[model samples]
Target: MKRSLSLPGIAYGGDYNPEQWPEEVWAEDVRLMREAGVTLVSVGIFSWALLEPSEGVYDFSRMDRILDLLHANGIAADLATPTAAPPAWFFRAHPEALPVDRDGRTLSYGSRQTFCPSSPAYREAALRIARELARRYADHPAVVMWHVHNEYGCHNAECHCDTSAEAFRAWLRDRYTTLDALNEAWGTTFWSQRYHDWDEILPPRATGAVPNPTHRLDWRRFCSDALLALYTAERDVLREAAPLTPATTNFMVMHNFDALDYWRWAPELDIVSNDHYLRSTDPESEIDLALSADLVRSLAGGPWLLMEHSTGAVNWQPVNRAKRPGELRRNALAHVARGADGIAYFQWRAARAGAEQWHSAMLPHAGTDSQIWRDVVRLGADLKALSQVRGSAGTAEVAVVWDWNARWALELPSQPSEEVRYLDTVRSWYEPLWRSGVAVDFVRPDADLSAYRLVLAPALYLVDDAGAANLTGFAERGGTLVVGFHSGMVDENCHVRLGGYPGAFRAALGVRTDELFPLLPGETLGLTGEVPAGASATLWSERLRFEGAEVIAAYADGPLTGVPAVTRHGWGAGTAWYLATQPDAVTLAALLDRIRTEAGVEPVLDGIPEGVETARRRGQDADYLFLIDHGGRGAELRVPSGATELLTGERIEDGVLTLPPGEVAVVRHPR
Candidate 1:
């Protein structure tokens, strides 16, 4: 695995926008940063309006001062291209730069990401700015990495104007080659939607005929491609100017956007980065963040960056709640515990005026020296002392296949319950592994499965023949497999296979499922044999007939009461288990406990309490244990003998380690 960017201790600093403040404030900002143990500051985010006020006008005088100030303070800066949002003048001059909504209404320049990615005017202007930034800042000592357009796909789709239509047609031609090939791939003959000419294809939006499934799918693909093309244009400009500095764009994990197919764009990035936000305080939140980090790390096959996070409460949600005292530190450490190399926040100073003025920031509107600022400084100090953890990578014995193609194909089907979401199912399986303290790699379906003794592919909806055969080979070779409901139901083209559900894995799983029942919201089905209270028995229930498998649990009530809800089958030296219904957390945890024991996957720590997560990473000679307390109250954790706290310099040997709420500790085992 490639090494991540994070050093051993902790990474310090937050967003810094010198453009928003005066020259005198820059010095004060640096002083405050140093005081807070801030080692890095992200500059130039949302500075397009200041950088370029008009067409053909370029200004970097202020940015130069900002860089000089940071360098003087010995701080590293993650510089942005200032291309996330073009100036209003550019959009006004080239009206085509405006994006059009799904209903065909052209968007105004009131919001960010309003520029149409397909518009030549926007692309040309964005590339020019990017080239200028790269050329000007390539040799600056303060600069660490180049951050491309912020969070690439906030816009759902782009303009349906003539320019976009022509580009869409070109994209289709490249993908299908000929009109006949396009017709066959989309299976357009079913709805008499066969296209005689490429021009017949129109952008799928809320406007026209509600769109056929094939066109809708292609439109999503086309939109993602367009955005990626935009990203590549800027990336090429930067690469030509400064090949040494790493180039990357912050990605949103499991977002509605098709950008998750980083496999298509991974080569363009020197380091993969993502912005993580969680809504719930449940254990799943940490698992989701870790999964995203693992995905990015797997993409580059190395360490990735935690590009953006809320220093406190974010303003985007309906209710913005600040991060509890130690939550920020705990969260940052959580990323490192996974595979994050670099850590940075969204904004350095809170906005003084505007929609996001109330959003979380490292420096509140009040100058500095607040509690938040103190925590920021402490985090910085910790990071500087602990840079030794940089090259550490997690040890994962199990891998979960997270395929975007399968996700898209499965959701496009008309029959399955909407409650059976792709992300939820993946998370359900992942939660157990995470809670059990077993590191997992969120790999692609085609990734080498031999490295893992256990493989979990929940909701493998779009199982191509090759993919299914791959799983079969793994099972035959003594690798345990677990698959859930709504799996093996369709091919890549969204067409259901005949015979029965789980068509291809029938022999491997040793079972056949013909009928699936969709339960309404809040409906409760029961599970036989000591099922936990509030366990969901009927989200997507299936009738099963075991060919060779033994039933482990069955429905306690309903027409299928006494039928199977869980089954296990032995195949070769390995085994296959099928979960026919969505169960509650307790039941899921219980099921995972059994699976973990059977697979012999070891946990990193024992006697860890709830809300306290444990993860371990090993260097050549030492093992590092990351203990994070996400619980409400402080914890007195017991550490193994002969270990030392890397952060606090305290020696521990099966003694109580005090951890305040939301606190984290990195314990290095004796060499």
Candidate 2:
């Protein structure tokens, strides 16, 4: 069934914890929120202590009043199950719920998510609380969604206790089935670490030295599965009472919680939700956030929620930098441009005490008249005015392939170059198209590539026969293919494919690599053709030999000097480009520009300066243009001459629309 939300216009507002404040402040908060046009409020986060002050005792009186007030004030609610942290009374009664660290020390509740996921006592207690919450409030028309646990994963390298050890063994047995199979998979014969029994297998821990990388990798996979099992158990219980309500858990972008596979977790979720934070100064931050957004959209194959974002600066990082004047508004627009169905900040009210006390909030304890509060209010008004244009936005024509199994297979390799990071390579390919205002959809490896004119696969280190066939088929049918180094070397099982490098893709790419020149850090290599400045040639550079391809650029210097750095292979009516070295941003951008022209790909907007992003989504009766100003200086954007700015009701038929820093314009052209 297709899922949809009731709240209109990019569900605005954020995490609101009014329970901590006195009732006297309720009226003021409601006024401030309504003034900002804030429509949705996420309540009950981090409220386990308030909800269950004592074991076997439940209290929702405070939460009830908060929700009632929000609903009465015309605000929708996304109620969270306050199960992120258990109450101290429950922990004291059931000490077994504590998670043990890798060094075998049991953890105490100094922070949230301290409970062990595999603990039976913890699961039972958490389910009881979730069931109670759903039963009591499932019928509330104001409640739109159920937020399970807040960011469900371990924060540190822990959970190596006895319970985890037992769970690890069970997880392995289900995966490998036999001791010999496990031994072979992990290559346990090396270092005389062959396991004689399933009992011998232990979870990865700091206490013991990791002599085998394969074993450590497997343990990571096992740990992720264990947590997924816990999440699934909780979700099942919630579905029993509120079967109609969508259940979701917030995810941190590119977070590696023992390699928890989000692709595997997507189907179980009603809508993918994530927290994206990027400063305004960073050039690639917006693109990075877009990658994460595309990743979630591809995982769910639909629109997702922007669960949490810093309204300004975050207090956690070593550098606490606030968003400059118009930065917050720009970031919000960027989210909508990338297919976000809802936008919510991390916090509503600033914390008066605790670790997050210094973090920025919509309404600081200093009150709602502050500069940050006013900015949020203005942005909220813009969002409310644009709500009528909801679901009438940009659509992506190009799809970038994102495969979880391939990502896992690449990372699992025991000897792959450490410099070939997955996320970094993916970003390298994505940023060029993003800056060029290309609407990109992150598609799974199995998705149909025919819809896209260009398909890019960066550091696709693992390629099964089926995936290889898909790529080859796409190219054979006149689709342009762009691939990067270290790709097509291994299979799904992390085993090297024989015959040659890029085993299954040798014929499709029209190239074969005989040797790889592993370049050390600070190594310099020049390209024969025009190259981008500041591009690092680090990591292992492959010395290539083309079978039926022409070299576009060769290394200008080095031992493999004058060898192929980039090659183009003609396959049927289309062509494929194999990049053997990481080029600088300028060179990469130029290369992408050339490819776009050759493939007849049209940009949504042309000649936009750096920090400005543009995207277009068209429906049967309307065309929506999402213009975001990422630049620090306000600039005039040349809208398509006759479009009208939907947010401000301004006509752009004869002149350019001037957008301030971090400002967004949603222009609609009625058909």
- State every prediction's TM-score relative to the real structure: 0.94, 0.93
Query: What lDDT does candidate 1 reach at residue 53?
Result: 77
Candidate 2, residues 362-421, lDDT tens digits: the string is: 886667667888889888877776665566534676777777656666665345465566
TM-score of model 2 vs. true structure: 0.93
Question: How high is the lDDT of residue 162 in model 1?
Answer: 70
Identify the candidate with maximal TM-score. Answer: 1
Judged by lDDT against the true structure, how good is candidate 1?
Answer: 0.76
If candidate 2 were superposed on the true structure by all CA atoms, what would the RMSD be?
Answer: 2.6
Residue-level lDDT of model 1, residues 384-487, one tens digit each, is 65577776777777878777777776666365677778887887788877777777877766667887878888878877788887876787888888878778
Each model's lDDT comes to 0.76, 0.77
